[model samples]
Target: MSEQTAPRTAAGDSTDRPVDRTGGGTGRGSGGTGRGSGGGDVGGPGTVGPEPSTARGEQTRQLILETALRLFRERGYAQTTMRAIAREAGVAVGNAYYYFESKEHLIQGFYRRTHADHVVAAAPALAAETDFAARLRAVLHAGIDVLTPSHAFAATFFKTAAEPTSPLSPFSAQSSEARTEAIRLFEEVLAGSTAKVDPQLRPDLPELLWLGYLGVILYWVHDRSPDQSKTRLLIDGAVPLVDRLVGLSRLRVLRPVTTQVLELIRSLRH
Candidate 1:
């Protein structure tokens, strides 16, 4: 399948042209500033304003985000700056900061957008497949497809994210929004599958699968294989084992083990 590209500006260009401020600056209620008067609150000091509510504002926001991601890919995350992103995006530095407070926020936006893309890409497979393992495989492959474009960037970004206390860590509180949404996607995967899971394991299975996916992503980051083919093989090999284990969870013999696992997970959370 062809790689899915990031959303582009409405004009379908990446030129460094200034944002059009012809009508009240980007959108209605924007007060000639990038921030709309009644936009969604970002809830932090020094933030320009709430998120843009108008279509034009949203387009501008997307343009900034796409530009940031591109620069991050080319310049490496540490070398890229908000000024550079704003200059490349053709928006004012304040405007760029208006959309994303910092580089960390931009990465969070990357996390959110990539997950959203994964969901859209996985929808077809989720709708067409009922078998547990097949559905799982489809979702996993879809994730790789969505991420394929960013593989080069991801390789370097992994170093910062790998730090246990870094906000970039997928398990960090700062990344909770993206993490929660990703786990929710796994829940959908399990919900639509035909597999009969243990009643007690149902609630926790999605999180377990999401954690497994993080492992897959880690492997993919280090995968030097052409086109990350080895990661694909890993997924293909791992899914059946996961499926079998999930299926066995319904057996009475595994109930105690499943409960112990759940208890351990809960303990770690606190």
Candidate 2:
């Protein structure tokens, strides 16, 4: 359902916390800021230096990423190269590789950046809505908003990411970090909601919601309608059905079926 339809509670009225839209976080490839000179040895092949520590270094890293995305949009993903990105970003080719090893890695950076933006964008809605359906709808809408700028690029890039063997695939090991973070966002949506999810199903629900989100993205990639309004309609329509199913999970009659579905999910994980 639309944001206008979602119910609110006193708890949902909490003030919003500040979010770091700067794409800073700890962990390899999490875009954590590092400490060091912005310039140094580029390092030999097969070896890379540390992440950007200084503000200047981080700025440089962001510059390269921004340039790469622009070029990816101007040109096609396949047509863009590291050298071109470095040149456009006004950094050495090695510096581009320093921040991101390959074009695939650049897309990974895009994933992290977009997710971070989605979190920031959804903070207001999350802070203001306690209904599970509303929170889910807000987060999903926030995701589409964050992704709208890259829609053209995503359409082209989907070909590569669709390949099972491609590192760009969302399900690939290379994408585990971003994927995990996305699932966790949904977990936050569930955790803060008033929905009484079945205890057995609670743990796996976030990933399932994430998969549904992927379905939405896939539809969005092909959505040629004005402003992708169709995709928004899809979300508005589907969330209530999801809410009903989640609500149904608490019924004793559905427990056995939920158990089976959980078993199926666990089996597929291995």
Taking the tens digit of each residue's C-alpha lDDT, what string does model 2 give over 1-270? 011111222222111111223344212454543322343434222223355776766787788899989988998887776667866877545456667756788889999999999999999999999999999999999999999989888887888889888787899999999999999999999999999999999999999999999999999999999999999999999999999999999999999999999999999999
Q: Model 1, residue 42: displacement in angstroms?
A: 21
Candidate lDDT (C-alpha), each = 0.79, 0.79
Q: What is the overall TM-score of model 1 with all chains considered together?
A: 0.82
TM-score of each: 0.82, 0.82
Prediction-by-prediction clash tally: 0, 3
lDDT of 1 at 265: 97
Best by TM-score: 2
- What tens-digit string does per-residue lDDT give for candidate 1 at 14-92? 3222233343433234475545344433322222443567676688789889998898789887777666787787765
Q: Any residue pairs clashing in model 1, and if so which?
A: none
